[model samples]
Each structure stands twice: as C-alpha cells, then as structure tokens.
Target: MHTHTSTVTSDSPLFDADGVLLHRHPDLWFEDGSVVCRAENTLFFVHMSQLARHSVCFRDMFSIGTHSTGTEASIKSESGVDEFPDYPVITLHDSAEDVGNLFTALYDGPNFGNNDPLDFRVVSGVLRLSTKYIIDGLREKAIVHLSQAWPTTLKGWDTREDTARSFEMKTGSSSGHMYPSPIAVINLAREVDAPTLLPSAFYDLCRYTYSQIFEPSEDDPLYVPLTYSNASPAASPGPHSGPMQLSLSDTQRLCLGKESALHAITGLIQSMSHSQSIRNSGVQLQSAFSFSHPLAQNPAHSAIIPHASNHHNPYHIHFSNHRRSSSNLICVSAAACRKDFSELVELATQHYVFDRERGFSDPLYVADELGQLKSAEFSNSDAPECKACARSLELWAARERERIWRMVPVWFRLSMDVGAERTASPPVVDIN
Candidate 1:
C-alpha cells in the first residue's frame, strides 16, 4: 500500500510493488507517491500502489536490481529458464529516444530474419505493452502487421485446389467472390455499373423473342399463338387483349397484305413527280372511281398508266363533280392501307424539300396520319368494308404525295432529268 512519486531522471530505478527494483535504465523515477516513465517521447505517471498491485512480477524483478543481471542468473539457475516472464518489465527514461530504441529492439527484434514463434509472440506482447504505455513506434508497427496480414492470407488461397481458384485468378480472392449467386451477380453488376457477361447472340435472340411476343398490332392474327407460347404474355395479358386474339393464320395473311401494300405504295411514290402531284392524282383517282362504277374500283384489275404524260395532270384534276360522293370513293382496302402509306413515306423521305412544303407534306406528318388510322378507333371497329376502302385510298394518296415530295429535292430532280434525257437519246453501241 506504499505510494511513492518520482520525476524521470538519468539512472532512475523503476520498482514494483514488493519494492523490487526492476531496471536502472536511463529513464525511471518516483515523486509525490507516483511513478513516472518516458515512452514514445512522452512522460506518463502512475500511482506506485496501483503499479505494484497490477504488476507483482515487475515489482519483484525491479526490487531485485537496477539491471536484469541478477534476475537472469536466478532464472538460469531455476527450472524452465527459456520461458518468458509472466509480466513484462516497464522502463522509465529521461529522453523518449532512449526508451523507443530499447522497445523497438524488444518488439521488432534485432534481426527480422529470425522466424521463431517466440519472436512473433514477443512482438505481440510488446505491442500490448506499448499500447498500455503509449509507445508510439510499437503501436504503429503492430497496426502495420494487422493490416497487411489478412490480405496476404487471402491471396494465398489462390494456390488452393478449388473451383473458386479460377475466379480468384480473374477477380482476386477478396470477400467480393466469397458467395456469389445468380441474383447476387446481377445485383453486383448493377451496383458497380459493370457490364453483364452475356453474348451478343443471346441479346439478339432475346430482342427477337420479345418483339414476337409484344409488338403491337390489332391486325396481327398470330397474336394469340405467339402470346400463349411466351411466358411474358401468360404472366401479363398486356393492354390490348381484345384486339390481339386474332388467329395465327389470320395474322399471317394480314402481315402479307401489309407488306404488299407497303411495296406497292413505295413503288408508286418513287414514280411520282411532286408530293402535291401525288395527292392530286389520288383525289382524281378517287373521283374517277366514285363516279364511274363499282367495277372501276378494282385496284388489281385496273391498267396502270405506262407513262407520266399519258395520265391526267394531277394539278388540273378536280373533284368538284364528285363532291357529293366524296366519302363513297372506294380506292383500296383497309388491310392494305398501312403498306401503301409506308411506300408514300419512303417517297417523301427520298424527295424531301426543306422549305417548300408545310407540315402535311412532310413524311413524319404522313406517318403520324397513318399511325392515327391504325389505332384502336379505326382498326378495331366492325366497319371493315368501308374502313378497308377508305384506308386504301388514303394509303395510295399518301404514297403519291411522299414520292412527289421526294422528287422536289434538287439533286433527285436533276438526276431524274438526266436519266430521262439519256433514255430519250439512243445508246451508241459498237459491235466488234
């Protein structure tokens, strides 16, 4: 229970509870009932009574002598001389540098080449002691060892025989690959913004399958067949079930008609002079069909005008006489309308004039118009006869207009004129 205090000075003896003198190192002292030690370049004070109670061996060793000579001799003469002391020696010095070097020798050891487990144990012991005593160098070295050890151990797993070996080689053996599942892989990719490792062909197949299942259209008869075969359709009927219940055969027929109409419209538009001319020509044809007879309305049976000049000039043609029957002008069927309109779009795209035409003359405008017509209100109704006829005429007109519009471009018009002139002039072929 004796309490003593001392200031660190040269040749101070650090003592334990039994009044045992531990070390006569350069640092250690007692003053005002407290013991002071220099560690990591700083002065630390502890009550002599508390130090004595907590470190009995330290006190006994200290009481023995100022240096470890007597203690070493006694330990050598006793059993198990090689055993480390149960308690470590605490030193006190006037300067932090002296104590730091002593601690480093004990902790790091004079030579790191000695791989003895005792050396490692000593290093660990010194780290705990340094922490308790606030020895900065020892604490820092301990932290370095702790930080470097785990990663080194993990990297060693690379040589192990396991399925994870390949993965380790590629991505490294961090906790990142410890337990990856399909869901986890997907989540990780999304979280890290990484690309999925799927192939391009897989992506294409997925897209094709998706389109086959979900591409919108009331006219598609295979809607049911394609839908029933796909998981997406079964899970979610989507927004257009009523109109999409068409038979597979019906869908095929509709697709063929649509394609044919598109080709026909495209060809006609390609032949037109100006977008306006196509519109005018369409109006004229509607009028002609409406006034003549039902027999005249057959698009397939009608003879096509071989030359542009032979056809009535669209600019001069008027629908005034057929105004009363304008709505009755049956031109083409509804099923063929979309195809025909697509052809007009192609023509208009080719003949685009940046400034002359307004909104309705544009290809986008024609596409919008066709899009509106194909919506539920038009295509899903029961008026197939009237709807089909009206759609066909509109399709043809739109195509003609687009073709003419495309022709208005300076480059296209010039090319056409040159081709025409060349055709008019007979080729000079020399036979050898």
Candidate 2:
C-alpha cells in the first residue's frame, strides 16, 4: 500500500512537536514529525529521530525554555537569561521563524536605531559583509552614507588635488581612479540635492577657477591704470602706451557719412599745416564804397527810401545815408547777423536758373557780391531777408577763412620769389 503526505501553509510560528522554538535557516521548517531544511543551497528532509540533539527542544515546542513545576518561577528565571552570559536572548515571543522574519524587518526598516553609534557600526559592518555576499541593498546603503558624509568629513581634501587623491584612496584603483575634483564635488552636491553645501562650494570653486584662469601679470597695462593711479604722477605713461592711433582708412570706416567727409577735410587741413612749406595767405575784403548794383546803372551807394507811416518796419534803423538816386542803405544789427549768415550760405550754394543759363564765367564774382552785401551797414528797420542774407554771408566767409587758415602753416617766411613779396606798403588783400 502507498501512503500520501499532505503539506500545510500556516501563519503560526514553526516549532518542534514538543512545542520548542526552533532556529532554522531561512529556507527551513519543522512541522508534525518532519524536519525540513536547506543546507549548502540544497533542500534536505529527515524524521524527528534523525535530527541533531542541539537542533531539538522540549516543553511547549514554541517556548524559549522548558516548563517546570513552578511555571511562573521558571518563566521569571528564563526571562533573566537575556542578562546572563552564553545564553541566547529571545527578541520576540514566537517561533524561531517569526524571530528571523522580525530581524530582517528591523534591518531593512528605519527603526534600526539610525541615530545610534553602535547601530551605525553594525550597519557598516553588515554592509562590509554584504559586499562579500553580493547583497545589493546593503552595498547601496553603504555607498549612500559614504557619499553623504564626504562634505562634512573631507575638510582638508576640499582642494582639487587633495580631493582627487582622497577619492582614489577610498574607492580603490578600479572605481576610485574616477574620483571627482572639488568642482565636481560641488556639482555632485547639486545633483544629490544637498541645499546648504551646494551653493557655498559652487561659489568657492568658481572664484578659484577664475583666479587660476585670469591671473594678472605685474607688467600688465590694465593693472597700472586701475591700481596705481593715485600713488603715481598723473602724467606717467600708464602701463598702457597711449590711446590707439588709427589709420585714415580705419577712421573713415568707423565714421558716419557726413562725419567721414568732415574728418577727411580736417585731416587734409592738418596735413597741409604740418607740411610747413605752405604759406599763410590773406583773404580780401571787398571795398564796399566802390560796389555797384547790377540791377540799376549809376545806382546810389547809400540811400534811405521812406516807407509808409501806417506800415510797421520789422527791422530797427541803424545809419541810413541818402546819396545820389534815393537808395536805402542799411546794415544788419549784431542780433540779426546769425540769421543773415545762414541764409547767405544757402543762397551762395544754390544753383539758380539764371546763373546756369548765363554760364557764369566768374565763380569768384558771386562770392565777392555776397561778401560786399555782408559788409553793408543795416539798422533793425531793414528787411529781415536782406539783413539775414548779409549776416549769413559774413558767417560763411568767417568759417571759410578759418578753414583756409587751418591749411596754412602758423609761421612761414615771406619770399619775394614766385610773385610773393615783402613790401613796405600795407599788405595787399588777396581773396582767393
């Protein structure tokens, strides 16, 4: 006849038939008359009679100790076994299997006395042991603590050189050779969300890096200008030589349209002046007394024609002269000089139809005419247009004279050669 064996899964603690707690390996159990255990990574089975003497217990198979005549006294006596040497202490009132489960839970949970020194030592020791056993969780926890404690403990190794060496020593050759620099440490802090240490380390690293990269030399020009200005004479050539001298082409390239033309003219005038061979030529002022208006034959040089009393004269009267033909002679007041000069320059530059048709032979004649009018005396009563035109011409002449003067050397010998002469007579006026 064949016999059938049944298996039962129970939440109750595992125990021997006599009800004594049994300390079995994780993959072992004791139920009814069977002893089931794993050894050397393999399962094995035996009867209670075949079990080792040390592996068996009597009196309430789940109990830590045997029940005696005085049960309370025996329980009390056994309870104190935890304080005795060479006695195994029971942490939980359950079978050895339940106790094993509880130990694993405590090891994995936060209730493992996280703040205690002894707990830390135990955890570290377990982690070290786990590395040999290839326990993933324990090894990972060890790494986390090591990385977290680095900033606080690695004080002397805050510099790049020191940090690199320390990291190498801690992790060993294979893993340690890839140690981070101080800058990398700061970056790691940022990655790991260490708020307090990250910013401080980051700033320090930045400053150090900048200092290394941009260290100033003793002879650097920028340093002299920025540093020793007060201690030294102001005229001393700063470490910098001088303002950079630009070429004409470069200046022209940088200049705006009208500004470029102006700079070109200024440079030309400066060059001419610097050459020193150029003479200081004089400009001629036209003789106002001899000037004749083209519009009328034998026109009066000075005359004042009265206007109607009812009409208001916009200009104030200066000196008015009545000479020959009833001509009104007027000179611009100083106040109206600016407006007249502006208008005359505009009129002089304009290409009038009459001037183009006539094919004017003498460009100098127009300039002379403008110059003559500019010298004409005028009161405030004179027409603003005439006064404005005269004043504008005077300003134009002054500016032109200045421009011409800039092209001449400040001092030059007057030579009789080339039609130039030193005469006892007053200087001849030449307005070219």
Which number leads on lDDT? 1
Instruction: Give all TM-scores, in the order shown.
Output: 0.17, 0.16
Task: Give the TM-score (vs. native) of candidate 2.
Answer: 0.16
lDDT by residue for model 2 (2-94), tens: 132322233323333233433334333323323333221222222333322212221113233322232221111122321111111122222
How many pairs of residues collide in each model?
A: 30, 26
Clashes of 1: 30
lDDT of 1 at 110: 32
Q: Look at candidate 2 and tell me the lDDT of residue 364.
A: 19
lDDT of each: 0.31, 0.29
For model 2, give the RMSD to the true fold.
Answer: 39.9
Best by TM-score: 1
Local accuracy of candidate 1 as per-residue lDDT tens digits, 208-273: 122332463433211332332111221213344431322343234334433333443344444332
